[model samples]
Target chain A: MTLKGILLSASMIALAGAASAETRIGMITTLSGGGASLGIDVRDGFLLALEQAGRDDIEIIVEDDEQAPDVAVQLADRMIQAEDVDIMTGIIWSNLAMAVVPSVTAQGVFYLSPNAGPSQLAGRGCNQNYFNVAWQNDNLHEAAGAYANSAGYTNSFILAPNYPAGQDALAGYKRFYEGGLAGELYTQLGQTDYAAEIAQIRASGADSVFFFLPGGMGISFLRQYADSGLDIPVIGPAFSFDQNILQAVGADALGVVNTSQWSPDLDNAANTAFVAAFREAYGRIPSLYASQGFDTANLILSALAVADPSDEPDAFREALRAADFASTRGDFAFGPNHHPIQDIYVREVVQEGDIFTNRIIGTALEDRGDAYAAECQM
Target chain B: MSAILIVEQVLNGLQFGVMLFLMAAGLTLIFGVMGLINLAHGSLYMVGAFVAATVAGLTGSFLLALAAAMAAAAMAGAVIEMTVIRRLYHTDHLDQVLATFALILIFSEGTRAIFGSFPLYLDAPALLSGPVTLPLGIEYPRYRLALIAAGLLVALGLWLLIAKTRIGIQIRAGKNDREMIAALGVDIRTLYTFVFALGAALAGLAGALVGAIQSVQVGMGEPVLILAFVVIVIGGIGSIKGAFVGALIVGLTDTLGGIFLPEFFKLFMEPASATQIGASLSSMAIYLLMAAVLIWRPTGLYGVRA
Candidate 1:
């Protein structure tokens, strides 16, 4: 054989390998109707981070869920079967996340969560292929519970909708709080009125009230809470007090306390730059969900840098576990169970001129894991 | 539960009932008068909310936005009735249901196309912003109280319009015998248009009022519409008084059951199991109540025999 022929054949083989080695990630998140604002923010944040990194070898297949669990499952299945996604990520609700994660991971594909780490996954059910770039389901609420305990509230009433997430939230609160619970009320999921619960709380004579009502339920509860004229402090997790509810509740949410792992006002170079870029691009303040999504994309990008693009699943999973990437929350590390161990802060809703925003008042805990971590074999 | 709490819950239930009545009243009127089951009624509610939010954003006046919402919903109702609903009057129930379901899809997609799929919000006016003290040291939201009062006033107004006025008599006559009324030279088509418009206006008002307390967005009205259907079915198919009563019972049972069921279960079961079972049962309480009511009174409380 001639040397010229050998060199031409080698070049042809290299070109074919490069084309097949392209890495692809599938993103499924709520992106239409009521949940669209949050979904759009997450999508934009992820894409922006990807663009800034300037890596064309990685491709993303983003699908809108419309906040339906069944649709989320279908989209995840499609991404795996048809698109042949190497990794799956981005789900906003714990219920939807729970539904999709089992299937994605069962197929031996890596599933990374930008948001929604349900307590079950953080505890006994933790899996090696699943990683949460966001905090555990209970971490933020545990912070709120810790804050409430510190405030000397001996008897507190609690309310949440009756769902797995809701039950987990109450359990999360009880994990940190060592006090007498005056009453615990679980209402129907998506309930619109709080009058009966308000009456019960008033009668219970609790020192304070802690709630875990997210989405539209949060708006309704906050409005009714204000209407009931209860002077007791109202505390909740960040999901109920974020920008989505802030816009609906407005002045009514003023002085309400909440706990979160990430806030727009966090002091860090990455976060400051992120907030500015997000506001410039979207014309709105980015929520923690957006920040987490941005971080997840960066995490995957960093892992891609370590693993050979042609490396198989096991190699990619190891690279992801290392997770050496810049995050808006600053210096975050994943626990053995693949959930983030991060700082949680207590924030109060305050009016900044005409706009309402959360202001950090105290740090409840730093680098915490779920209480059920002891039970997790992983 | 203490007396005060029970009273408060009842009031809450009544408030919820009244809101359902507003929705159910329109639904029942349309069904009784036209023999049509319009599933797109919820879309009209969403339209009212969207319109109110947009106008309020532009004008910065809640009252004017509310007025505009009513007018816009009425116009929308009239247009839908003339163009789409008129074609379905002679059709069967299944076809009517399917067409209105299609209208829901069209309305939702069209709304998203115009509003860009994000939720729009409406703020409560300053006057009704704070909590007001009611009799017996019960502090309640002024806006909610206002809603209850408005609902009662609407109920009275509807009664007077349907019972005392000439249009009311014509409507009653029309409902009793549409062909006979048509034979008597009544413009049945115009009367049908007016009835549909009136129903739409009520639904619009409910949407605008509720939007202040919840996020206004596409598909927002669907859940409430389902409850309204349950209300009318339990109250009686064609009876307004039945709708009112059924709304109250359903609302109170749902709210109170959610709160008390877990506690009740805790008496016999472990806390965790009780919570799981209780939550599930609370969601089903109203449906169970409706079933029991049906077993006893199949035609509903105020339903007249056909």
Candidate 2:
């Protein structure tokens, strides 16, 4: 072997030998670029959970993915090969999760996803080593569809960016909404202008509109929609009306209905504590993404307490599947696909004094698992 | 679609077109006069938006925020031209591209550092917040209509400044033969600085105007920058008239193609697959247009003959 290879092996042996029971956790999340806010919240929430648990045996290494799939793959490789991490988590985007999760799981490392539960991973690609703390990608959209039906909407206009998640969003909505679609338009991903789409919506004579444009695209759409003078009631996944986004959207998003598995105002003992602690720590309201990260960390800690990852791999997997920890989303449980089966609630955007945040109005889908779970052989 | 819907979509196309023209005009001017391919032009646009958002937040005045945006971007452009871009003028295109690309990273990080990751809030002025009825009984956003008018006004002003003023003569002479202008005792360096700053101001104006309707966030300018480059390329490099025409073409093709292509395909194909194919094709429509333009008249529709 070359001297470099020999030295690396020596260090690996030393690291392995030195920490008999220490677990290394690798976190790959978007901490820069357009999606940085989500990552920051996730990281902060994860760190907050660990700090509260006081788990010094768990060594967590965080790296910025820069919202790119390729960067996430590289970080996963480096963490697995060099750091010899026993657990991996903290991928926020579905595309990046798809890029990294399968390979990491195949390599015998446990991956606990804090966010991004793409349907592929929840179905045919399901692995024993993978667990998702967040709801499946289509869960909120499905809830939106259910809520729309209950609200007695007969005609709805739906739109989303043309991508995998966008397709999932529309399909999820269509699965439950029995109403006839007034229009369905798939604009280019990252498209900021929605004037043409809005014009079509104005002309379509729809009773309601549903969209799934996340991040800045959502902000742009909401602003333009407000300016368009079209008064059709609008609904979407909570991604568009999240705390961080609502601040950017200003007053335009007020009174909009959105569906989510968790909200800052979700009334529960765990959620109340999480919101308080998160505000104390970050000086901002926690988003659903943050709650997901917190729950992911708590689940890991719960599993670690029950069985060791390196020594009792099967037991650790079973422990994760059991999901014994108290979730910010109360009554969380894993479905057959290891994705969360939880109540998805409908929320309304409201201004509490100065800050814009969501208030839970009603449960759209209670104990809702994913449609793809039956496809998973596992 | 009804005729009224078509009219509204066309108006939307014109609004988007004018915004693209604002960005492309500045980019074309800098390239035309200085022959500098500045990728950092987008960063300047971002700076303008962020500055506008901050000013509007603090002062609660949209017009003042717009003025601040222009001043900040122009000052930034002048400084960058003097300090960093000035040296690269004598270098090759590769070096210029590399340096300006690095500027994009620096500016993006710097803006993020100051503004944080969350997008800042900016909205249209109260006077232009809602829609207005047009002659054809079509309702459109007053803010977008104002954008089209402002863009056309700027285009007219730019045309007048270039065609009538003495400084315009110097700029034209510099584009043709810089050494000749320098020999004629023109302060060519100052002229270059002024031109860069002027280009920067236009981009800033576009950013502030568009920022009212769009999210004012980091890395917001890069996408528009790509479209602006496509516009300058299709309009012909170093041609102002080409940039304007090219921007309108791109904007209309994109907006109309997005709305119409799927409907056209649904006549013969299943609606689901038709939409999938149509959406995919419309995203590529601009690139295909650029390719067609290049093939027909290499150097662009209005590119000066080599």
Candidate 3:
């Protein structure tokens, strides 16, 4: 075709496409480097949910953030200016979320968090355009704290990486723990060696150890802790005991209690189907991150079915607030801060045949909202 | 802290220093002889750990894994030296840095492509898995003790090889006057390749030993690589002795600072603020030490004054 004819046809096609009201979603997530697995799982789970829903009017654009907050911010800008997405989601880290969410939401774009749920977003900084399908940052740690109280531990030693999420972890544990702290230490983030920390734990005379080291830091700490021959019981959030990390940790992670809002074996139709479908699709057990991603996608789809996101903003926001979706975590609902107010269960890591996974032992917290909800104006 | 705890912490510092020396030793040696700055040294370390983990998974033998780690890393180093690095030897530091930085990306993505993003499992030998009580009634992991011994042994071997062997003579000669030695009929290229491979093997050994204790994941070497750079800087670049002393000082400062800084601050400040300040300061302790060393001795502790 001639140049002018081609240009005319392209503009016509663009106009035709715009008439259908397709919801454009921009996903900026960690896809390479150290934290790639989490982002990959989240993307896979999100894609799986979208596939299951079979939504034809939704368009998604994915970009790698490289686990860097600056890169995430840049991608958010590009997505907003260049792609003009109506919604944003799929940031795996709290710091990255903190960097991108406020600006995106302030610009009148809806952001549905898949994994990261920073306290700032759930507190006074909460935005009407922002929704977190996952529990607040402190939810699982608070559940672990409650479980620690019931386990009858009078004294406990706690540790976490020296970062915002780590501070939140320690504070969350302290909120409901009701135990005397024998020690409270913050190690360097991404620190591989825990000898100094382990020595302190051994010398602290604490009854048990509660730590919030996540990802490879958790694996290293557990292996080194085991080798140090400290027999003290350990408790943590599910990021450490998740299916992906558990295999790397091997038998050492077995029988360790962890808390989370969802599990592969939660004994619900939604969860059972999610697990089966996820395994068939990805050929591995889905992690809590994957579940959150799945839930986030389904939440979007549910809202999309009732109203166009870019056209009727108020109605779409209400539809999202209603959360009319079958969550893998049964009976999921949003709190005042637009974060989940849901039951957090305690799970013990166990081996089934060859694969290592978590099994729900008991409920730790029932229908728990976040501590920061009171601070949220929205 | 109790006497036993202090002793244990000291041992931990020594072990950590020894491990850093393995990484620094090769780095210093390579810089000394080749005058090439290789940022991809860390990639070699990661390659070592990955190879070790793969070998261990297949054989279930820790010894075999270590051997394989050294072999694989040395091979990688030689290949890198010949293909990409050989051309950069005559270039400026910026060009070398850019080229090697590109290599880091390539190796990281390549490893990720081969082994998925998940961390690999590599455990210490069963015999060395538990803690052992020292003479001072301090219980420490036997594997760490082994690590210290192995590091010292390697240090000794390096010292002997450099001080007593013909290749060591050529290496020393090359560092001083490469053109002179080359004109004297020593194949400078072969010597450079050999020195690089040897350094790579040491780094590999360190990676394998440390990987058993830590998670064997992609980009695991970068943090240690930064510390290794600090070590070589403090030890004086291109000086193995300097690297050794610098490594020990860094390790001790880091370990002891982490444990005692908070306590020191708690004596005056409130507990919470003290903990925060102490943690922050402790993380900066090594860098402070490096600064102090640099201020006192611009040439580094053992660095030869140019």
Candidate 4:
């Protein structure tokens, strides 16, 4: 045997193999480049949950996916092969999740997703080992559509990058939006300059604009849109104006409405404690990604408490299905497809002191379920 | 589209073209004068943006931010030329490309280390934030109009400098016969540094100006850099006038093609499929234009005979 392998075996035997009994959880999330802040929030939230639960027996390994599906797949393989983790979770992008989940779950490791519930996973591709503690990708956009309806906008300019998630965003919005679209443009992925798009929107006579350009793209679009002097009211999913990016967007994002499955102001004991504790610990308000991470950790912890997943696989799956934990978003439960069925809230960006933050204006969709869930035989 | 709408879209295209000229001017100059391929030019553009954002945050003056961007990028370019770029002068194009590519990673990571991963904010001045009515009753942002004016003025100034000044004569001589210029009592090394820094400063100026309206983040320059490369190729590598014409062509083609192509296709095909094809084609329009230009004139539209 190699010296390193022999030493590892020696160490493994010396600890009475308490490590063998411990439930190792592998978290693969985007933690660098454009989506770094979102991944950092998820990691911090997950760690905070583990800290709060004060679990000594659960071991966690974190890896950054760098927003690349190939990287995520490689990390998942290492986690399952080398670390022998019982559960793998914490992917933020739907594309990466779609790549990593299918193969990882086939190997018998419980795959709990903190975010990114793609439509494919909700339907025919759904696995017994997979559980999504987040809403389907289209849920928030659908809520934005419902908000557009209630806000009484008759003509809207809609645009998203031409990708699967981007297509889902527009389709989700159109499902509920009663208004005629003045313009429906699919921009290049990672398009920064929006002057042409904005110019077209101006002439299209749209009373409102709904876009789904997330992260740096959203910041660039909003800044240019604001500069273009088009005073149309803008709406989008929460990913467009999240806490991570609001600082960069500045006043351009103010008064903009977005939809989310959870907000910091939910008026629940668990949520209040989470928001306060998260701020106290991290010196910033928790984002929606953070809430998802926190819930995913607690969900796994509850299952760990009931039965050791390594020893009692069936009972462990049953316990995870029970979802016996209070979520920061209040009462949360797993649907038959193992995705969260919960209320999505509409939030408005407002100046909170020197920093920009969101306020829960109203609820848009209550107990909304995925359209793809019916196709899942599970 | 309404006549006014058409005019406005055209104006938008002009604005985009002008900004691209600012970036491509420097790139073409460096390539012509030094025969060096700089992949890190984008990183320099990003440097200008980050420096501008930091300074604007501290000073709250857009003008100061612009000045700082120029100085910072120039200084950085000088340092990079002296330390790393000068050594690569004797090396082939492949070596220079690989070295500059490494610099991009270094610059991006180093900027991220200082600025953090989050984007920085730089606001347009209050005076230029609002819209103004032009002679044609077309309302446009005063800032964007001012950008077009500034870009044109710089182009004019560059034209005068190259055609009328001592440094311009030296620069042209260096591009024509570097060894001859060096042997003729000119400090060719210093001249190359000056040229690189001038290019970097122009890119920085573009970055600082656009950062006011766009997100100031790491890797912001790459998209513009790629477009600038296409501009240089289309214009003719060593020609400033070519860069200007090429930048405008690319800018207009990108902007106008994005708008009208889909509508044109929608006349015959399903709107959904039309948009798909239009977007795909428009995104590829400039490259296709570049390829066509090359097919007609292999070196470029304004390429000088070797």
Using Cα atoms, each model's DockQ against the true complex is: 0.57, 0.58, 0.61, 0.52
Interface RMSD of 1: 2.4
Per-residue lDDT tens digits of candidate 4, residues A1-378?
Answer: 322333344345333322554778888987776667778888888888888886656667777787888999998988787778889999988888988999988999999988788888988999888999978888899999999999999998999887667877898899899999998988866677788888888889999999998776888788778777789899999889888778877777888899998887778999999999999887898988899999999999888889988789889999999999999988788889888888999999999888898889999988888878899986
Please give the CA lDDT of all the candidate structures: 0.82, 0.88, 0.88, 0.86
Report how far off residue A51 is in candidate 4 (Å). Answer: 1.6
Model 1 chain B: lowest-lDDT 10 consecutive positions: B1-10
| Alpha-carbon deviation at A33 in model 3, angstroms | 3.6
Residues forming the 10-long window of minimal summed lDDT in candidate 4 chain A: A1-10
List candidate 3 stretches off by more than 4 Å: A1-21
Candidate 1 C-alpha lDDT tens digits along B187-243: 999999999999898899888888887778889889988988888889988777788
1 or 4, greater by TM-score: 4
Model 4 regions more than 4 Å off: A1-21, A250-252, A351-355
Query: What are the TM-scores, per candidate, against the unseen true structure?
Result: 0.92, 0.94, 0.94, 0.94
What lDDT tens digits, residue by residue, belong to model 4 across residues B51-128? 999998899898999999999999999999999999998899999999999999999999988988766777888889
TM-score of chain A, every prediction, order shown: 0.90, 0.93, 0.93, 0.92
Tell me which residue pairs clash in candidate 2. none
Instruction: Give the TM-score between model 1's chain B and the true chain B.
Output: 0.95
Winner on DockQ (3 vs 4) = 3
Supply the global lDDT for candidate 1: 0.82
User: What interface RMSD does each of the candidate structures achieve?
Assistant: 2.4, 1.7, 1.7, 1.9
Q: CAPRI band of model 2? A: medium
Model 1 clashing residue pairs (backbone): none
lDDT (Cα, tens digit) per residue for candidate 3, span B91-185: 99999999999999999999988997777778899999989987867789999999999999999999999999999999999988999999999
lDDT by residue (B92-140, candidate 2, tens digit) is 9899999999999999999989888777768789999998988877889
